[model samples]
Target: MHTFSRADFERFGQLYDIEFRFPAIHGDNSTDDYIVARGEITEHSLASGFRFTFSSLEVLEAYDSVSCGHAPLLVLVVLDGIVRLTLGSVEHELTPGTAVSMQLHPDYPLQAHQPEQQHLEIMALAFDPRRAKLGHVSPSLHGLTILPRMPLRQWKVPHALQQLLRTYAGLTMTGTQKNLVLEGVALQLAGLGLGSEEQESPDVPVVPVQQRQRLELVRQHLEFTPDHDHSLKDLAQMAAMSPSGLRAKFRAMYGVPVFDYLRKCRLQLAKHYLEQGFSVEQCANKVGYTHATNFSTAFRREFGFSPRQRTVDQKK
Candidate 1:
């Protein structure tokens, strides 16, 4: 494992305007194991805003960290342990098997509170739009300007993809081979996290302006009011389209099934409430779930963790 010292961490703090607090060591001379408890952090820089970091640290004591930077994009995957993070104005408790993606700015840096006595393994990829060329970027990101902030996106990481990331992080190869592997991994992560892709040869059909506007209206309703009991028939009527047409066209426009998107929004809201000290039952009611059991099942499927895992105690 790579070794780091207190001095090294201090330097890092200075560079990133980050503040880190942990248990102080007694002796003047301290070893890596004594300093980090266990595991290590491996970082690889690809470009101005493109960086990959794999961290597997056994935290010995509870610690807090806050950092501010101007990176445009960040993709984080939690392989183990819970990550309590507050990005800008929102807070989230990330458990194992969950992945989160966010657009970040210098104004609202990521604040993290890491609990001790458990091993934490995570992989993070940071990229800047101005510094790198991201071809065929997602439509939502096109003409992207640096905004004050943006909401985060969360999802469950597939088991296969999780293993692939772990393999790439632990590779011991050096030189050209290692660089090539890391670059590939970074691209794959960008595609999954940022919704970027390669240019397609087929030309996409032009959507009518009114039709597109109607679809957007439905989308905004789902995002802003996820607590409502939404059905395809009802949503289609709101959009002035038939149910089947709404289903096919909404997926074509947004790249996700309509109800699937609604479920994600509902669960995301539920997770936020859970972190804010709401009980699972309350969260279920707030998210339009009549049955807490059904809501819990969907929440687990969406985030890969039990709803109770995000309680305030677990958040610690």
Candidate 2:
């Protein structure tokens, strides 16, 4: 078994030009071990934001369980596929559009994949709450209060949070433009996670006549670019409103959050592919899942049957 600490992770970068660093653990491995798998770990430390990471992994073998962390403090955003982890006897999962924070613990159990070449894509930020700058977030961002006692807790990562992660995860900008986008999104996440939560509201506002058109544009963009990573704040900016305003208006207009709408689009597209004789892997990639299992799981959940079953019916 190959045990990895900070230095070993860094070597994956230095030795192979991978963006990696530590506080992570991957059991035993050798250079040749990567032949059956392909992945990347990108870790960056923002001058103004917290330390964060983006990982996309595809594993063909699942004999030895791979795990990471029990970190000092961390926030996680799972974009695709199932995240597997165990704490003592309890197991936890982070699906798409969910956020979570974990504190110091001995071992928090983990794995990057399942059998059948399942892929996982995740973005995580490591932080110290006492010191992170939360910017101008509302006081009601406390959906993350699990336990100072050492366990995992779920947080409904808002649309803005999803946008922030997506914007950064799929960014192609550079220099000042890149930094501005990163800093802006990072601050949003900090505020969303660490900000003092506001009380829930039963009554919501109606969208203005002018704002309705803009929200339509946002929806259209998501529909067309179902695979593009979108940031809620940026989309709101495009819609000429505050992020909150855009969210309210969009729900009023479409009755679903931005990504939820996108998911429906992706699933529909996957169905078309399945009927047109595309393989599950091809359909998964076409629809933005890094792994086939994740795609199948999502497809089954959305359509109530496995993609394989769909394929069989298509043949029949």
Candidate 3:
């Protein structure tokens, strides 16, 4: 077992990013801000790694597009702001109050976009399932319960779970205190994410290749027309799928229930509008919210802040 108190986040971001689409990252990652990505590794038997981080990169900027292909399964929780991720052909809008379990199982391409100059905070936990060759006589790899074996499953992170992650991220405790606290919290979070797997079972039939293609069409439609009036019947009719099948398969493939995904899209569009000088009312209308008050409440609940708090920030 090993503990790393201060870890380099941007450096690790490169371990995946630089290899794919990003050429370089530029921002003020001075000494103080540069090394807060922390983790603990227990490699005695099973090669297990857990990292819980709250990274705020001031003046953070990325040059070029993100083209991540085939990254392993991990639990990603967005605590603030929005992160747009394209996994395979299905694009997902990850906002606060949302969590997803996705695996980069060979050739599954992922492209992520967070508006430049918008600070984002997230907690990502990575664990390896492979066993170590020489450690504690090699046993108990399956005992690790936090690792997601099911691949691409997404669900909402409960408020209590969100609080736990935030507490761990902001902890001033160090040395053994940090390690003890982190391992417990990380495992707990993982277990919570795994609980979402009960939604899938032997009862639900697998989606066919052609229906999956139709679902892709539906995904593209939502992406392009985030504000359009969409109904489940209309969407299922368009996709040529039974309503029930469409609902189940959509959640299976995209990790979000249909209505939930729609809300994510609407709020994400609202984020763009608010950040672009639109008044709360105007933005609310643009995203199809009937009232500004309702929109504000939803936005606050989603991203941890009110729309009034965001300025029409131009890149400085």
Q: Top lDDT: which candidate number? A: 1
Worst 10 residues of 1 by lDDT: 142-151
Give the TM-scores of the predictions, in the order they appear. Answer: 0.56, 0.42, 0.46
Winner on TM-score (1 vs 2) = 1
| lDDT tens per residue, model 1, 1-316 | 5554556666777865777766455565354344544578778876424678888888765667777776556889999999988763347889999888776645556788888756888998877656555563344443333321123677788798889887875578998777677677766665566544334335545456678768876876686678888888999998999999998778766768899988988888888888778899999999899999999899989988889876845568
Looking at candidate 3, the ten consecutive residues that score lowest on lDDT are 37-46
2 against 3, candidate with superior TM-score: 3
- RMSD (CA, Å), candidate 2 to true, equals 16.3
lDDT of 2 by residue, 1-316 (tens): 2232334444553642333311222455334333343576677765443567786766444432433433334677777666655333234556777776655332334332233346666787754433345662223323222222123456778876676676665678878787666666655655555535334345756555567656756765665566666788789889988888777777765567777877877887788778779999998888788889988998999999999999999999
Ranking by TM-score: 1, 3, 2
The reply for model 2, stretches above 4 Å from the true place, is: 1-36, 63-72, 106-116, 128-150, 167-169, 194-316
lDDT minimum window of 10 residues, candidate 2: 16-25
Clashing pairs in 3: 71-104, 154-255
Model 3 spans > 4 angstroms off: 1-14, 17-47, 59-72, 131-150, 196-316
